[model samples]
Target chain A: MIGRLNHVAIAVLDMEEALKVYRDTLGGIVSDKVAQPDHGVSTVFVELPNTKIELLEPLGENSPINKFLERNTQGGIHHICYEVDDIIAARDQLVANGARILGDGEPKIGAHGKPVLFLHPKDFLGTLTELEQA
Target chain B: MIGRLNHVAIAVLDMEEALKVYRDTLGGIVSDKVAQPDHGVSTVFVELPNTKIELLEPLGENSPINKFLERNTQGGIHHICYEVDDIIAARDQLVANGARILGDGEPKIGAHGKPVLFLHPKDFLGTLTELEQA
Candidate 1:
């Protein structure tokens, strides 16, 4: 079951500009951009009191977010992550409920080094959802 | 300055379907649907430990989310609300930094009955942002 709202990931064309809005303009405590080549994105964390806003920029040519950026040129909210206690049990429950799991239907070590899986957007009201093990 | 991430609003075309995904599939604590006719939307809150997810459905003829639902079809992330200690000060800071405030540039009572202002998506990398007084 979903426990906490982990983070909201926003795919941006320009990380610097995104930082300006979330960090400079909004006065959030932002982390330095960190490249996650494995995940094919560069990430910047805007730390809020209760949660985090992750600003993502495509890292390479085949980055997953490149397609999202194509449709949303200026960038957009890519996905919302929820923390789950037991990911396997959660996935099974979701599968039983007719919700599709994305990729190979296996949990991958996510950016935060936690097991995570992506759920099909169509099953989630067009919102791309990520479930991370708490 | 942005303090907490108050909530993330997801606009959905079908409230029942959205509830099935959030409550039944994902096992989140969902609140009963409450129609905010003044705001032209019906809202359901998925209470998470850290924050909340607000599921919105068009309530009236001229619902604000109607256009968004038209474009997305299946619904999508509408906006993210961040809490601030002083909304006026936050507005001035954002305005000074060249962020455009939506509407008449004055804070209005949000769905939560707190002063809130929406920022232009163009100025926010396509992510509609709302700032509410904490």
Candidate 2:
């Protein structure tokens, strides 16, 4: 079931500039940044008062973030992450309710040491959804 | 400057079913429901720890959320709301940076005593962004 919102993902063209803007101009604080080579994207997290804004930039051509950035005219929110108590059950329930999963049926270690699985954006409106199980 | 996230909108087909599931099974509390006849849609907000899940159901033929639900196979995250200090300045800066605004250039009173404006999804990489000034 849905607990607290983990974070909101935003796809940006320049990670550094975006980070500076979000952090310095907007008064957001950088919580962390990770280079997800497997996904071919680099991400920076800026923590706000209530939520964190995730900045994702594509690392290569085949990267999904690259495609998203290529299609994006301005930096926009890409996905919303929900912290769930049970990832498998959530996935099953979502599938039963006609949602599609994006990863190998199992939860994998995500950017911040939590298990995460991405829900396919094609199946879920044009928005990507992620489930993080702590 | 930025304030709290107002709500996380989600597009759905059957408002009743989604409301039941989110309220009963997920332990989400339905804060309020409104039929925005002007916007040609009905929305219900389920409050959680930090944010609310907004369920949007299209009401008529030309509803924007209708097109969204049409494209969406499964209900997904629609837009992330960020409360801003000033709407005009934010709109100007975003436009200067090549972001697109969806509505006519004025802030309107939104669902919960807040002035809201919609930014074009096309400019934001298919991710609908909203700015709410309280």
Please report the candidate that would top lDDT against the real structure.
1
Interface RMSD for candidate 1 relative to the native interface: 0.7
True contacts kept of each: 0.91, 0.44
lDDT of 2 at B14: 75
Candidate 2, residues B2-102: lDDT per residue as tens digits?
Answer: 57777888888778777666775455678667888776778898777888778888888887776667656566677878788888888777767666688
The candidate that wins on DockQ is: 1
Q: What is the TM-score of chain A alone in each candidate?
A: 0.98, 0.87
List DockQ, one per candidate, in order. Answer: 0.90, 0.37
TM-score of each: 0.99, 0.77
RMSD of each: 0.7, 3.7
**Which CAPRI category fits model 2?**
acceptable
Error of 1 at B89 (Å): 0.9
TM-score of candidate 2 against the unseen true structure:
0.77
- Give the alpha carbon lDDT tens digit for every residue of B7-122 in model 1: 99999998999998888888889998999998999999999999999999999899999999999999999999999999999899888888899999999998999999999999
